[model samples]
Target: MKTLMLILAVIVGLALIAGGAILIAINRNGPAVLDTVDRISGGKNNTELLHKQSLGVDPRQKLLVYGERSPDEALPVFIFIHGGSWRSGNPDDYGFIARSIAPEGYIVVLGGYCLRENGRYPAMLQDTAAVTAWVHENITDFGGDPERIVLAGHSAGAYNVAQVALEQRWLEQARVPAQAIRGVVGLAGPYDFYPYDSDSTRAAFGSVGVGAESQPVNHTSSDAPPMLLVHGEQDSLVKPRNTRALAAALEDSGADVETLFLPAMTHNDPLLALANPWRRDPRIFDAVTSFLGQHTALSVPVQAETP
Candidate 1:
């Protein structure tokens, strides 16, 4: 009887240890962990880390360039915007994405923009447009093909990128041609949430008034670039309906659009997967790379220098 009790106690202890480790892995800041590891490793060995550069005057406006710099030959570029509910988040938080995708022969640009506290509604949109304009004029210097730039983002950043891609006003205001953007990739974005009930929503979109102009779904047009909309099936923060609604609108407008709904993913899971490639759902990377390849000249893989 005592032997039986001892065995049960051992089993319970092992279960508790496993459970605690799992919680720590999931709850920890994945990007911060990667950043710390990269720093300690003397990041010079990582091509992605070595090629990172900042653009624009504000500290918030930065870009992480990936791949070898080839001034003569312009390479396809991907500008990724980070998400923090339009309140917090920086380009540095998404270095993992650039690190993962840059080796595939594309110049990944992780861009940062103003948040709600700086300005609301069109403010963030305008910031993104400015970044696009900068990329169009100067990306060639960084081995990026200006003509084949793809805009991508997650959550609030997705909303910003979608708005900039769908509506021409912001780009026009920034003196960037509407056709400069070749494609868009959005993850768990809120495209049709209106009648704001939450403080965060009200802080960003409430003052603009609940109108069709404020929604990305209402801004879709046939002229808009091809889009890949990804959403988590279990996403409770933004809901899967946002992806469905945007897809429907884009299709209705005769625009090229694709949608992917991953099972058992939450609002943050997709980004987390990008940071930790070994985690659940490698499909996010596959779908993004495949989609970009189909639309841009990113099919060729670039050779990374051995560290």
Candidate 2:
């Protein structure tokens, strides 16, 4: 019995040490580690094309602009929002997305927003709206056509993009016309989730009196911009039902909506596929570029090259 107890205590001590090390690594060198991994895996490129610019008074409210080296030509613009479960996420992590898509003759902007811990519900929505308005007003100087703007997001970011597109009030408050958004792309987004079963959802939306008000599915309208909803078949995190239900709602409202379900992909696979040039599944990239082509008038075909 003493021998067994000693062995168990040793295992527990090792586990505790490992856990502490991981926490310290995450708190201190997480971003650098991610950057290093992205570089080694060929997931990072076109960084020279990225230009950092401030959007508001808060330094955290800045964005990275990709493409538009030539000021003479106006290009379609795509604004992307990264997802981190409404708790943590940074625009820097998604730089590969802009690098992958910008060469396709579109100016891409990756923006950051307030997390649920910082503020709830409308906080993220408001930040995205402000960035969108800023793009509409100033993107012209950066060679982007303000009239041809597409919104794209992954996971929680997808939820924010869809919410702002559907609710209209959020953009209206920012003085941006709802109709200005030409298209939307959502990957593994939670659109119909309700009842606030999880702590993240509860913290982000439980305070709202009407649960339906928090759902993008409840805000569908015929005038909504064309939307492309992509989900992983094996995504247990957000569930395929979210995409199906939102597509149904958009269809019922006479809105243009397209749905694609990738076989054997997890919650993060779809977004990662955007960064990975050698991804086996071509559906995600094909669907996104195709959808943008059909909706937004691209000056040139997407020539996104693998690094």
Candidate 3:
């Protein structure tokens, strides 16, 4: 049984975040824009413990939990990572994603990981794995079932989750079973960028010395979990080829992979669709929820027979 929620009393549109004004400027101060939106979203929904550290090893890590939990029932967990070129972004700012999904009968976790001073790729991967492992061990306290966990992320965060799911060592290091991750959802992620040409890519991975080991595309196997790779055909930031290459590799390896290439979407469109007002844009959230449902997370709890 899912926890109860009343969509609250706020109007559902841009006006909700526009502060009684019809026109809001997006080109100005992105932080302020998100702050306004987060505040409104936070109020309308049950945003509790907007921040918390994982079990112990990583303190800089933080996370936010969305949705209420019923004492007698365990819902499958959905863990989401944020995009910031692996250098920027805070969990508090990304609650809109959790807000949109948690209402659909899932315990949505907006997880954050430590980024050391000039930290490279595997460090984030380790923290993400640790967070996932910790959630698996302890989310029962929050009414989440450990056996059914789905991972999703956007851009750099997308790369993080996808890589963590594809590569065995990171989760293995954290002592989490690979099968615990039921599926992966990546939005505008760079899965095959090896040369490291862009400033963001070069800074986070250039020190890695041009290796495919850090790339998720090279790690596909027949045993790989199902994946939904979404990219904007119009995305100039990371390019749609990243998703294409990874999907092709997974297909060749006899793995289950699906893709949504939005011809009109930019890098941020898929992400924006997860927030209020834009959630009805279609394909992104619908495809993800549908994919995750095919796994263990979306079904109704099995009721034990009375003797």
Candidate 4:
């Protein structure tokens, strides 16, 4: 009887040890990270102005505002969120991406949020939703229309944006309707955080398990806003399958979803091309612009300069 009791004690001890290790991994931050990706990203520009605005207090989030201010022009707004695997990315890293979208007559806001190391799942999502609420309430002062807001982000940012759009609880707390969101775009984001396998992922995310309900795929419904999903065909970091799964889910629910799979690009290349406008591909811009135009009645009017 004593031998059996000793064996049970050992099993209990191992379970406790494994549980503690998982918690530690999930709560740890990756590294300090930091971007304005508004048009005129990597190149010199004498025209566009960059400004910083504080979005909140008590773990304050700062937003980078890039665009031309006008007295009579009420422009569309693109609110950008950056991805760092939930632990390491900074907002300024996506400035080039912001710049490419800004020239299309939108006020681009490249913004930051508290990460998992600082907080956790709902905390990061709350920070994003709060900043977005501030934009809806105050962006017109910067020459943007509150009614024409578009949320765009890469990787984890994409997931956050998708959650806010589908879940609605976050936006509702801020008095912003989910339908007020004109569009949402995710670039190679892990929308489904609850993983079935990959103990590392499970360890990193903790008890918030993955399921269809946890993924953005599970939230698709007829009333949801239109979506644009951009994924690199060769992106192994997040897997192109992630976007494919989401696209299928959205289509199954009758939501307007579009997927653009880029060739010869990886996770970082598409974002880099935003600042190095010379590297920008016409097809990418076309796909995004087409979706935005269809939903928002806005046009880019691009005319090739070359003879």
Candidate 5:
């Protein structure tokens, strides 16, 4: 009995310590804490932190590049936008995604957009388009192939990328050619949530006024780029129905689309699977890499042979 009590005490102590650490991380660093946790969980990786710089006056418009390449070697680009319900998060917080995807023969770009004080539907969309446009104009300096740029995001971010790729107007407004976006990878995104009722949806999108125009599902076209939409079967947050609806719309429009409803996965699990060490299972990572390989000129598998 005494031994059992001692073990229980130790377990409780560890739980308290962990809980406190998490609280501190959340309070001090916001969602950037996930980047630190992902790095720790990933153990060791060869991914390099290539650059950290702001593209415009808004601190939220910062960009972080990840991967190793020669001064003039141009590799296909994969840009990931961090999700925080369209109200929070920044590019640096999603380095785990860059670390996971960059080593597979790509230059990974994590982009930030206006949020909280200066964020809303159109503003966020415009910022995302601007990031793509900026990458197209200057990514060559960072060893990225502008013509093969791909867009990806999670949650609210997923909506932003999907809208930018599907709607066309956002990229057009940013002065970026629509074809410049080769493909899209969306993780648990809300593409058809109109008549907003949720706090986040109402807050981020209410200003845009009522209409299906903001929904990505309404913008599918035969000329739309190939897309991969992933969702958790057990997800209650965004719901797998969102993926199904969007995929059906894309398919009906004669657009290339793929859907993965992962069993037992939750809303954030798809994003968590992108962490390096967590990728040992390889299901989510494999799907993303396969889509990227199909669309990009590299056609390389997830595992790039080392020299």
Candidate 6:
């Protein structure tokens, strides 16, 4: 009895420590905008061109596509969502993410999302699903494979990825198959965060805690797509345990999930690095390429016909 009691006590203590750590991380101030702006802008390549096109007339939402040239055949498409505290950010902020992965034979789509000011919860989710559906229907013109679409996001963007991937309704309403999602890459996303009494968080996230109906972990099952969860060990924003907990739930459901935690990097660093490849953690590129390679139908690059 004494031994068992001691073990139980240890377990409870560890849980409390972990919970405290996550709150601290969520409260972290992240980095200054100037720092990220300088890091992202300094590494531009004049040789590579990024094409900007409007997907629709939302005024707030525009599609920024990146690649060497228009794709001729069905190629893997990565729809990247930018992270802002669900308040501020634009498609331009994440154009670098699309560029970094385009060379690997994937079309990168960067677009804006509705903010808390515009709406919240299902509204943002609906906008994300709308973009996914639009890409699936029209990306063929640009040589993107609708069947191999993948969702990649960071921070709040990460959280949105989890929401759509786990919950079937958003994608279903858009008429996009849930099975069509090949993979998901969530960077420092809050998978399950619900503080019922905290009005600030509740206003944005309501009573749905991490494992609640709205949380991604709640929807993990064998049929869902594979997920890659990455985090920073020293990150004081979004917390590593969020990813850890989501990974555990995914594993329990027999889902193929992987995690990579960077040593010294922080929250915004990963987002900035996704654009300026040289400044990013190599593991970020490696994991993303590996995921895309797994789902692509063509083992080798499709060759264009000779003139």
User: Of models 5 and 6, which has the larger TM-score?
Assistant: 5
**TM-scores for every predicted model:** 0.83, 0.82, 0.83, 0.77, 0.86, 0.77
By TM-score, the best candidate is: 5
Cα lDDT computed for each candidate against the true fold: 0.79, 0.82, 0.79, 0.71, 0.86, 0.72
> Which is the winner by lDDT between candidate 1 and candidate 5?
5
Which prediction has more favorable lDDT, 3 or 6?
A: 3
lDDT agreement of model 3 with the native = 0.79
Count backbone clashes in candidate 1.
Answer: 0
Q: What ranking of all candidate models by TM-score puts the best one first?
A: 5, 3, 1, 2, 6, 4
Best by lDDT: 5
Q: Give the better candidate number (5 or 6) by lDDT.
A: 5
Point out where model 3 deviates above 4 Å. 1-32, 38-47, 54-60, 116-118, 208-210, 297-307
Off by over 4 Å in 1: 1-30, 34-46, 49-58, 208-210, 298-307
Better of 1 and 5 by TM-score: 5
Across 94-119, the per-residue lDDT of candidate 2 in tens digits comes to 66677667767799999888875564
Report the Cα lDDT for candidate 2: 0.82
lDDT by residue for model 4 (1-307), tens: 9999999999999989965764354334211111322332355542254677776663436677777656368888888888776665666555555556777777888778876545355666788898789888888888888888889888878888988888878899988877569999888877655654544345435546435555677777887889999988888777888888888888988888889888787775455445443345676677776766676665679998998
lDDT tens readout by residue for model 1, 37-95: 43444334234543454555667866666666553467788888888778777777666
Give lDDT tens digits, candidate 3, residues 1-307: 1222223433454447765442244333332355456556545775344336554455547676666746357878889988778877666676677667776778888887765353576678887897798888888888888888999999988999999999989889989898889999999999999877887777777866647799999999999889999998999989999999999999999999999999999888788777665665767889988888887645579899999
Q: For residues 63-121, what per-residue lDDT tens digits would candidate 5 score against the true structure?
A: 88888857446889999998888877877778878878887889998989998657776
Residue 57 lDDT in candidate 3: 55
Model 6 residue 57 lDDT?
A: 54
Worst lDDT window (10 residues) for model 3?
1-10
